[model samples]
Target: MSRIGKKPVSLPSGVTASVDGQTVRAKGPKGELTYVVNDEVLVQLGDDGIKVDPRDTSKDARAKWGMSRTMISNILTGVKDGFEKRLEITGVGYRASMQGSKLQLALGFSHDVLYDVPEGIQISVPKPTEIVIVGIDKQRVGQVAAEIREYRGPEPYKGKGVRYAGEKIVRKEGKKK
Candidate 1:
């Protein structure tokens, strides 16, 4: 049995959730989100909260049960409080800035790279070396951060590049003369 699936997703204050067939919808002050559960999993809203269970004892059903539960939980949290991701740029001449709806990046490249911010997501630069992304959908916030990081990922040798905030890079030894 999946421990995560066994626990019901408690609704945060100011949040409401409803189940329609295999689709679950959550609405809150932040925003609204919907998730379609797999057929192998069963979802129901009860007094305590939303409950998830495997439709059968098959491997696929068990695997999807936990994932479906987590997805429901994420939507609830997203609609209530939202999600955020932060990135830090470390290197000489490496920085980030906002140009209207685009994110301007100077990651040692010859020309500055411009990333068009997607809808439903907000990007802010508190400092030249810091970038903050906010969105109601947790997956979209993480995906935007990952795409930005991929532009100038940290190198093992000097660990100079863009990385997630609080991320640790395993530094490699410099060349021995």
Candidate 2:
């Protein structure tokens, strides 16, 4: 049995969840989100909370049981409080700013990198070196942060680039004299 799947996901205050066939939709103060459960799992909304059970006692069904439960929980929490990711730029002349609805990044390139902001996601640059990505969907927030970090990953030698706020870079030894 899946430990996580055994536990139902409870709806917090002001958050509502509905079940429609294999899809589960959640709405809260922040926003609304939906999740389509896998066929190997059974999803239902009960008095306690949202429950996910395996359709059969098979390896694939068990695997999807926990995953489906977690996905439903993520959508519930996401709609309730939202999600955010922070990135820090570490390099000379490397900075970020907001241009209209786009993100302007200057990472020692010949020209500034302009990233068009997508719908339902907000990118904020409080400081030139700090970038905050926020959205109602947890997956989208993380994906956007990863894409931004991909632009200039931190180097091992100088560790100069964009990285997660608390990420640690493994340094490499310099050239021998």
Candidate 3:
């Protein structure tokens, strides 16, 4: 038995969970999220919490059971508290700012890089070097942060670029003269 899959997902006060055929939908204060339940997985909504079960003892069914449980858990958590990703710009003149629905980044490029923020995602620049991304969907928040970080990955030398907050970059030694 999978420990994670066997655990029941506690439902919050304001969150509503519904299972329709192969799709499970969760709605709460933050937002609503839907996930497709795997074929080998079965979901049971109890009075106290939600439970997930595997249809068979096969390997594939066991894997699907875990995955389905995780997906449902994420949806429940996402609609309640949402998700966030923070990025920090490190460099002499590297900075980021928000203009309307776009994020303007100055990452040592000749021209400023403008990244359009998608709907359902919120971008905030608390400081010139700090950026915060917030959204109800975990996948979308992570994707946006990854795309921004990809523009200028952290360098091993000066460590100048975009990276997650508190992330460390190991500096490599330069060639001897």
* Candidate 1 lDDT tens digits, 73-130: 9999999889999999999999999999999999999999999999999999999999
* TM-score of decoy 3: 0.96
Candidate 1: minimum summed lDDT over ten consecutive residues — where?
A: 73-82
Error in Å for residue 49 of model 3: 1.5
Candidate 2, residue 99: CA error in Å?
A: 0.3
Q: What is model 3's C-alpha RMSD?
A: 1.1
Instruction: List lDDT for all candidates, in order.
Output: 0.95, 0.94, 0.92
For candidate 2, report its TM-score.
Answer: 0.98
Poorest 10 consecutive residues by lDDT, candidate 3: 41-50
Q: Which stretches of candidate 2 lie over 4 Å from their true place?
A: none
| Top lDDT model | 1
Our tally of clashes for model 2 stands at: 0
Name the lDDT value of residue 159 in candidate 3.
Answer: 88
TM, every model: 0.99, 0.98, 0.96
lDDT tens string, model 3, 15-114?
Answer: 9998787788899999889998888888888886888899889999998887788888888999999999999999999999998889999999899999
Per-residue lDDT of model 2, residues 31-141, tens digit only = 899999999899989999998999999999998999899989999999989999999999999999999999999999999999998899999999999999999888899
Which lDDT value does model 1 have at 97? 96
- Deviation of model 1 at 81, angstroms: 0.6
| Between candidates 1 and 2, the lDDT winner | 1
Clashes of 3: 0
